[model samples]
Target: MKGRRRWRGEHRRFAAVLVLYTLLLLLLVPYALDYGARRGRADEEPLLRRCPSLEEALSEWGWEQRPPLDEEEEEEDEAGTAGAAGNGSAGAAGKRHIYLHATWRTGSSFLGELFNQHPDVFYLYEPMWHLWQALYPGDALSLQGALRDMLRALFRCDFSVLRLYAAPPAPRDPLAPAPPAADNLTTASIFGWRTNKVICSPPLCPAAPRTRGEIGLVDGAACEEKCPPRALRELEAECRKYPVVVIKDVRLLELGALLPLLREPGLNLRVVQLFRDPRAVHNSRLKARQALLRESVQVLRSRHRAEPRGSPRHQQQHLLLPPGLLGGGRASQPQHRAEFFLGGALEVICQAWLRDLLLARRAPGWLRRRYTQLRYEDLVREPRAELRRLLRFAGLTVPPALEDFVLNMTRGAAYSSDRPFLISARDAREAVHAWRERLSRQQVRQVEAACGEAMSILAYPLSSGDAR
Candidate 1:
């Protein structure tokens, strides 16, 4: 009887310990989950942060607070005096190339169409995107992710190309399934193309002798003519006159990879950074209504929340980025309409202002000097003056035709005014203060909260003459 009682007591004690351990784990599970989530997700903290910490910059408009950008006048002088850029007469041989660098919904398409007005510019519309999607599929990335990889891949590879929409030698189908063993980032046999001209690979074809320029999109030299003659002739003709080529598609925002082409000795390049009020941009996005807008909004929201003044380290440490940071999807809904128009719109404004503010604070002088900010409102208000400013910036003459084109377009007398030109009624009403009337009083506050840095950058004063 004594032995039996002792055994039962010991067993009960063990059971109690087991129960306690289980309960402890249960109690600790939420924290463990949070830790794991923080570790796993790059944007977990900002995702949780309410009212992004952007207010710190508000007191000084991010300009006063930031260190001044240093100029590289010497670098340009050295290049000019030392003949670093081909006897200091860049493109004197008539190799004119124009580049348009636009952020989303900033009237890029309209600008592209307008640029096409130049008798010389061919203005190819996003040719590289589809081909990029085809050539490199990775296991870790979605198909779209693979496309971005292909874009980055160009930096390491020969960049020569025919139609960027079609890969060299032609894949069986541009939209085929990604290859086996395809983790989203690794090259797959099907998606990966080997060419030393493109990157580190054996010769794509022996007859070609692996030249180190534009990556060929086909297997042979004769294939150079394979791209539609109309296209090539148009491009060549444009270069003959303007020497600079530009495609004003906001879609090409990731085109830093195209810098190699611009840097070549034969081309003189200027990139125009154009943008508009976010609500107008949101209106354009509204028209583009795509199902992916939800994801895009979530992404933009997170991006806006990240890198708040006090949290640069957090953003860098967490690797936080907007969805558009890597690439963009789309969104089309009333709320999303409101998101971009209202919420997403503020984020875009922040980005544009922040980019200019940051670049002014950090980039080299020539680049800073070379960069031009063309707000759509400025164009709308004074098209001739703005056009002249643009011409002067681009080192082009103030041609009568160009001036007339601007006059005609702004007067609502030219080229399909029926189609919205990426502006809201309010956008036409006021440049910075347009949001005041469009959004509800509460809605305005939400935007204010979201866009806490406005008073400093856009000259938006403190909210409410009285309400605060």
Candidate 2:
């Protein structure tokens, strides 16, 4: 009996050890996989070696002085077999890929439109938005991975790959009929502005009979007729042909997450980070809440009109009312949408601005050189000078057409945060400091208190009365 008892105890102990081992393996596997992937990428690409240091990289901008290249380095350069294939002017083909990274309410739309107006640029707006919706409420790491993968495919002009992760299965009520299967739609068609622009742009598609004012109302048939037989193939070909490909996304404030792409050899990427004053950002977000509320009301009204009364369609509309509508408490709604646009507008904007600025400052030298920081104030105040600086950073000569585009876009339009769609150069200088008149003293103080460190780093002065 004693021997049998001892055997049973040993068996229990072995089982416990095995269970613990399994749990530990589960815990560590993700980290291990991530590390391995990063290691593989580093091994495959050695673009960082060519940069040497941040100071040397910035020396090209005439920001600082550095020693000239040594005789050996010059010889290596002349032999046409020097550093990485994507280094300085020698490696820079006319082709470049640019990313404009910013947070919402930072005048990013205007900045994006600047690139969109460039004839040589194949500009994309917010391609990762669908991914965000599909992978609703994922953990930060998972979301980052999804975003990175989507961007990789996009920059490579592999549009079909997006369909794999673009739309997840929508939840259905057991009482109602099954939701419709999601179709494979091109990224441009998924976004309203992009859909209109793609249909109208002569290079991307043959122009339809649409006036500038009526461009946004283009029908599906018109777009389909103009689009190439294979949208993805044609887009990829265009990407190759264009001198520059620009992607503007406000969701890419976390600079650390994109370091790998900056170092990617094939991409030859550059970044323009746009920032606006926190007070202005906060005020703009508050104003935007009204716009969002109106949009939600419109959506509700449209649903009511489309669905028959008391039918499943109408019932589902009530049960799963869109987010920020009638205060429905659906987890999926919050998961898929930005809360900043709903409530606590000032707090969210201030915190995001501070966090993003800190993350950007911590980026390594090589990565930093690839980024050019532009203040909304500066860009609006001196459009031509800022445009020149931006083009220079991208290693492109300022063409007459580009200058004309800038002037035409901004020359006579009023500045309003609410009207991002309108391109106007009118009263641009006044918009820079308009926050002073728009925000209350208490509001400005609140913003300053939350973002004091970032404000200091960016050289934005605190108001005299609000100074701590």
Candidate 3:
């Protein structure tokens, strides 16, 4: 009996020790997860490395090193200056390239259209779309590099070269399953445009074929006939002839990554940084997530009906569905995907806005001169005035045609934000403040908590509770 009691006591002591160890691990788990997340974010973003000495320049925008102008570019600049001195038309001769920097769901499509509609402006809508597809869901740094490199090529009018870096669209059969969002390389997926405007544009292709309506589609015959591969010299000449080239990309929220391009010689680079209310941005992103999820399910279902159930094609289609799209062997609802993918939506949007704003604020005077910051609210509130300012900044005259286009574009009843391709100014005023109704008080608070400082800097007022 004494031996039995001693053994039982020893066992009880061991059990207690095991329980204590488990409790300790549970207590430390959250902190450990948080540390890992922070470390991962640091590795992914590395904002400090991208813009060294950010603290010193936070108060005032300054650069550590100025990009040196190459000898050839310097000579070209001098020649351009001399020509400007002799003729008043020299300003027209100097081509302007504008970068519309924005974040997702910030009304960038509308802003891009404003430039695209202009006759003199050769607008490339989201050239970085290819880059995103090429580096889909990769490290943030790699995406940034791809964005910069692609922009460099596009600005230089090197269309043939971009193909090297960008992935070719994957082959699809009528019965094949739609690729996951990351792998989808349709024209709309790769170029962010429903039409092949960039490929068929006058700068890259012959102008005569552009008159045909069907040329807008990316048909092989139309491309071969209209966009016969031009030599580099011819492409460059066409680019020089254009007064302005506008490239709008929402992925270019990282202003620091674009500093090098701002300093590129001969090519005049200007930036229009567009921002929207953080709450609105978050809400729009959620809505977009839902739309994407719905579209994915429909496509998957259609593909399922077309292909044999147990065939290799069906199996391939099943595999193509991203994990986010699938839940328990079936397509998940949009809300489920949104919740799973974007649980911290408010924080993510706020952080992105803050980072972009901070980077733009710290830009040097030279870059700042070329940079224009516009709010979506402002654009919607006074479309005419804001557009005039934009045109002036872009060095484009407000022609009567442009004025009419703006008026019609903003006032049309057919205009809806949901339809990206359709140019409509309908409900412009309401769209600016729609977030008030869409975002819950809790959601607003979350955004305000993460972005209070940025909001203040950008002149966005916070609720009393959210005020710093």
Give each model's whole-structure lDDT.
Answer: 0.43, 0.57, 0.60
Candidate 2 per-residue C-alpha lDDT over 1-468 given as tens digits, one digit per residue, 9 for 90 to 100: 999999999999999999999999998999899999999977774323422332222232232123133456434433432222224332345356788887666778777766665545567777776665565454322355567767777777667655665545656667766544444444344433434354355555556565322212235567666654335556567666666677887544245456667666567677898888876776665555554432223222223222223334432322222234446455446422433223233333333445445545645554555678999878876788999788666655556665766655555555563465443455665566667777667556656765666788787888886322
Q: Which TM-score value belongs to model 1?
A: 0.50
For 1-468, candidate 3 gives per-residue lDDT tens digits of 999999999999999999999999998999999999999977773334443334433323234367435557645654664464345342543777789988667788778877766656667777765555565444343356667877887887766545554545555686776544432223333344333354455546555355322212334456556565444455456556666788888655357677678777667787898988776676666667764333223222233222223335532422222244544543366465554344243343444456566666655556666788999888877788898788777767555665666666556553256654344566666666566767666656756655566788789888654322
Separate clash counts for every candidate: 30, 2, 2
lDDT top scorer: 3
Two-way TM-score contest, 1 vs 3, winner = 3
What residue runs in model 2 are displaced by over 4 Å at the alpha carbon? 1-94, 138-142, 168-183, 191-199, 208-230, 290-364, 417-426, 465-468
Instruction: Give candidate 1's whole-model lDDT.
Output: 0.43
Instruction: Return the clash pairs for model 3, or none.
Output: 410-425, 415-424
| Stretch of 10 with least lDDT, candidate 2 | 55-64
Name the top TM-score candidate.
3
Instruction: Give per-residue lDDT, candidate 1, residue 462.
Output: 45
Q: Can you rank all candidates by TM-score, best first? A: 3, 2, 1
